[model samples]
Target: MNISYQLTQGQIGMLISMPHNGQLIPDDIASTMTEKAKLVPDTDWYMDKLYDFAQAMGIATIIPKYSRYVIDLNRDISGVNLYPGANSTELCPTTAFDLSPLYLDGKSPNEAEIQRRIKNYWQPYHQAIADTLADMRQQYERVVLLDAHSILSHVPRFFAGKLPDFNFGNADGQSCSQALIDKVSALDLSPYSSVVNGRFKGGYITRAYGQPEQGIHAIQLELSQYTYMDEPSDQYNQQKAEQVKVKLQQFVTCLADFANAKS
Candidate 1:
């Protein structure tokens, strides 16, 4: 069993990744965290639930079992900042987005511990992604990858004011073909705001594996949690969730069709 994550094969040559959806914290690690950190507020709460429709769409999906506090799989294993100039989080973040300490005083994971987390958590997730794509690529010439994520609407540490409801990133058009991007960019972004290649222009997973020239295209979508969640409380809003999922199903279906046509 791949204890690190859950993966399912797709019939449509597409993969959806939710790296931060994990909320499990090993007791050994939780013992070192602050009271607030133990709650795992930084998690992409309920993302697996939010994107559950992908499974019905025959889109392969993968979600990690451990919290990002264990290791940020979206981040580079070397701990390089995906956005160098901006305030960014690390592979094993010692502090929360609000600059609050996640660990107790001097109880943070050190360099050695960070490396251990990478080996234990990060490596497995990426290897599964690479391995699955390798197997799928043999059958399908071009496979589309959708990296899904969500965040609080107003994270001052990352952006000012409220964030766009839908933030699409394709590593600034290098990760996917123009045809794929145009299709996603042309979505009916009414009522909700959206921007392409804005504050978040994709992360390690999109940049590292997205080789459009090599017949692998990737796109990262960052949604505002307000779109489907009641924040702080994480109450399930079936009405809000259904509305968003309808829109997502349309987008993913278009993406899959576009990738095949381009290939």
Candidate 2:
């Protein structure tokens, strides 16, 4: 079997997590899914290419190997909703973002299968994050996590209209310090709209890992696909990516600086 994830170590106090970056759906699972499910449409497309610049900045990163259709890496193992009383996907999702059924009739994984996936896939990716953060905690005074994600510009299932280009979620100030939030809020986000603690206020990873009292901070940035790619075609747009990367660089630099700063 392919490794559960790829971990790129770095000499810094930051880790960039691309939890939904995987696009591969195993054949056994694929055989049970619908044609639309086979497409893995909800996968966060091209995040590896989008964040490729992080490697040169001495930033660590963790990206999983299997599509989220297999198991959502950002969700808690207990299968609690990240956003309670709101429309959300399951730990082992049964449908796509558009509410389309992912599996064929009665082909969804059973409880035992879900447990197997948790053991084989979810645990390793999260363990990697925990281990990396532990190591960074020992090396730096402050450790930061940037949970990177991208979504369709308009997913009516979740929200009414087009999403803000950049959605920053710090779990309503539970995940990071207000000073850091203020610093981020002060950045020039002209041309592209943004909102903090908006529709998406971080997921399990950010909430679980972020502990300001422990000198660890976390934030989730959910970018709209329209900002850097042709959403319909799902193709990379160099011009778009270049333009957005300028802003992204500033955003990440701020997070890195926050991590490396002395108390």
Candidate 3:
């Protein structure tokens, strides 16, 4: 029944998530979407591939099977706004990142339908994350959850200027320990920049599950698509990926060491 995702568990105490990389949409839902929306242009395209090194490294990985247009698993399912002043998409976003409508006229889901989608699509994904973290905690003294995500370099709706190549979020340090942050921050992504606690300071998954005091450290990295892919066009280039994969491998190696580090 959990047909909406792919979960792979590695021997290590880390979990890599591609929550928004899904592209499938139910027939009924797809029929109601506009041509532009059908392309799912705003998705974290090729993120699962970008993070493929995690699988080889034996890190637990979880990815959704349905498009984020179905339910924003990164968002709070309770309907509370994650970014109040900023123009953000909802749990069931009806518009693209550019503010263009996704649904056909009057075909968007209503409140009752939104709740139904949450129960069917959203809750299961979250429960899987929670359960995985709990299970990992039982096996390792510490667990690191790396939430992987990406977007266009410049989405005028979310931020004013171009986004950094790496946007690491730890819920202002509440979702993780300073040690882990320091390790990742020291990465030298030359020609590519990074920021901690910037415009994107983690989302619901990081804020809700990260409990460093309890030995669970969570971090969310929102990468700029241009760093590893052809931006706006959304193409996946092998040469580009190969280059970025080197840096990513370094990043994941750091997380694995942090998780297995002795106290």
lDDT of 3 by residue, 1-263 (tens): 48888899899899988889999989888998999998999999998888877877889999999999988999997878877777888989999999999999999999998999998898889899999999999999999999999999999999988999889999999999999999899988776789999999999989998999999999999988888787779898788788877887888899999999877
- Can you list the residue pairs that collide in candidate 1? none
CA lDDT scores, all candidates in order: 0.86, 0.93, 0.90
Q: Considering lDDT, which of the candidate structures 1 and 2 is the better prediction for this target?
A: 2
How many residue pairs clash in model 2?
A: 0
**Which has the better lDDT: candidate 2, or candidate 3?**
2
Best by the lDDT measure: 2
Between candidates 1 and 2, the one scoring higher on TM-score is 2
Residue-wise C-alpha lDDT for candidate 2, range 67-151, written one tens digit per residue: 9999999999998888888899999999899899999999999999999999989988988899999999999999999999999
Per-model TM-score, in order, reads 0.97, 0.98, 0.97
Which segments of model 2 are wrong by more than 4 Å? Answer: none
Task: At residue 203, give the lDDT of candidate 1.
Answer: 91
What is candidate 2's CA lDDT for residue 178? 95
lDDT of 1: 0.86
For candidate 3, the lDDT comes to 0.90
Q: What's the CA RMSD of model 1 in angstroms?
A: 1.2
